[model samples]
Target: MFDNLVADFERPCALDIKLCRYYHGQCEDEHKRKKLEQKSNNSTSLSLGFRICGMQVYHPETGKLEKYNKYFGMSINDNQAVEVLRTFFGNSSNTNLHNISNTVRNIHTAILNQTDFVFLSISLFFFYDCKKTDVTPSIQKTDIDDQNVQAGFKVRLIDFEKAIASSDNKIHQLPQRIKDNINYGMVNLANIIDSFVIEK
Candidate 1:
């Protein structure tokens, strides 16, 4: 239920809700049409020259080869056959290929976006220190600024190691949001430290 909510929110606005609902399995016939939509999204936007399910017709974008009666009404011939095999064989999935890929892409994009907050935090910290120091520090061990910089660095590093080890499912079964927030925060923090770190 939570995944459904987040997945809905994750989609960029302006995309048709009806279309999204249709794809996300909100309707009664969703299961039946799942394969068709999977084919559509995975391949790319369809053109007028394209054919619908169970019909042997050429798609303008995909040039050559008519879609046969299968996953997307397409045989997936030649090199495409290899790709199709890989997609299905590698996953042991019952869901259509498009849905599978969509889920993965969504997770990936979410994790990446979550990390952006980390960079923002680091950049803000850098500017704060720069204002006091009146200049940027060099990123080296010999160069140091302010008091106990090394202690701060060490504490931050320990915190980092703890965070990563804790976030893993093995050590701690963390919620996705928590994992995302931590990872994003850590990445940005690392970036900021790298910008003007010194080993004084």
Candidate 2:
């Protein structure tokens, strides 16, 4: 019953990135904690603070939509994350790096403004039009009024079932891991997006 986010786009491409270094939040079971830890360590979530969970990309050349499962995401290393983003952003002449940069900046700013909140097992959902004709060149001349949806692309934070609000005194009092915070993930994500934008 949920609304389709990419309904407007002729060819939509989407990427789901799990955020934060730690996925489990204060699990009482020791075995479960170790399992979650191992899962995070094996994926880019431990090293990069974020891991690609899944993706659906439309390849114009092949004229088909390609699907990538969690296994493909788990196989990617820190260095390959940038290339993955590049593929998501596309390399068409109509691709706008500034739009991507602005999108990252907006997400970073939103993260910065959110204080005293611990987000666990959450994800970032990125979607855009894969068709070159639907890609807008830049933010300046876009007919769409929403700046967040520039270039027919949008990024949103999703999956809050495991999120811990500041009101949770227990979590606030607990010792925080180095990269367990949402800010850590956002910073790493911004850096990765910047790297891709600069290289382009």
Candidate 3:
């Protein structure tokens, strides 16, 4: 089931190797782990974008791909994005709040950076693990003796195949309309993250 597309080769190749390592019990530091989660999520979008641009996805280990957060789950619908964000970060205690906030900020940064290209529509997909988290309405206050619990996050944009450059040569520059849309998206994303964090 592995179809090799010209443009999608690099990202999937790199990501698949890393994922294979992770699955085989290669542990990574927190920061690198967070970054790798983000990268793995984005690799799916890159794959779709390449296909939209007429490149095929090189299929390798379809079963493994289907098992990762990247391929197995459904896309977060517009209405669900906010709820998903809330659930993903809502249950963390104060100590974990900082890391969760950092993850949200990182996601915002990634979205802003990637959406520089014109896009007709974009959606974020949540990780299966994050989706499984129990989001209680009220999180108990952090106790001094409590052990640190860091919940990893994975969220990335999709449906970029409809995306295109505003101009043939100006691939890096997006038009005003696209910029406005991206700004709006980021604002909503930030609001969702803020709604979940219990202010200390």
Candidate 4:
């Protein structure tokens, strides 16, 4: 199951861990609780982009098939990739409607802690588009900060916002922009980052 999710994208590791923790009752954040509901209702393209890539998706209506969006990594058609998404979704549990509305805000807490999903997503893109550019340069600085996160050095995050932005931009290809908005909902995003000073 874990392998399938990882094969679906770049790093389902974080998602696996988050979902695991949630299943075991570990994560508890009101903010995250709110967003998980949103995540569940988010667009197929957004979800698919984070889950797979390198392909075009279409929204099929009663008699029409329209190109929805395009991605550049992994695929819904690959055996391994298909397995991952299936495994992840297959394991999703049922929740109490009352708890979801009163005790908790959404169905799953893991989807809201998005850093893992974003990181793993970068990996999938590389898996499919390794030749686009060297990904190391984009990640090196942040990696150093990740190490210093425990050292009291505030870390700033830039890559995350850009990732979400790029994802949103990719969905504009739909002819009905409002329909796209309905699928994605509102786009107010927060960047989970801190400023860090290196004492070199």
Please name the candidate that would achieve the greatest lDDT relative to the true structure. Answer: 2
Ranking by TM-score: 2, 3, 4, 1
Once superposed on the true structure, which residue ranges of model 2 sit more than 4 Å away at CA?
92-95, 137-149, 178-180
Work out the TM-score per prediction: 0.17, 0.80, 0.37, 0.20
lDDT of 3 by residue, 1-200 (tens): 22232232232311111101011112368777776545434442222221111111222324132122433222433344334334334435554555434444554465456634555444443222322243232222343111122432223343445455656554445445433443444444444445565554
- lDDT of candidate 1 over 9-109, digit per residue (tens): 22111100000101222236766678746643453112111211222222223334332343452333224433332321231222222332333233334
lDDT of 3: 0.36
List model 4 lDDT by residue over 1-200, tens digit each. 11321243322212110110011111388677656444423423244323232322211123222221223222233244434433322211122111111111111122244333222121111111211222221212343223221111112221222123426653344344322321121111110000001110
User: Model 1: runs farther than 4 Å from truth?
Assistant: 1-136, 141-169, 186-200
lDDT of model 4, residue 60: 19
* RMSD in Å for all candidates: 21.2, 3.6, 16.8, 19.8
Worst 10-residue lDDT window for candidate 4 reads 191-200
Error of 1 at 54 (Å): 64
Runs in model 4 deviating more than 4 A are: 1-13, 16-73, 78-83, 96-159, 163-200
Candidate 3 regions exceeding 4 Å error are 1-89, 95-98, 111-116, 128-152, 169-175
Compare candidates 2 and 3 on TM-score and give the better one. Answer: 2
Model 3 TM-score, all chains together: 0.37
> How well does candidate 1 score on lDDT at residue 87?
25
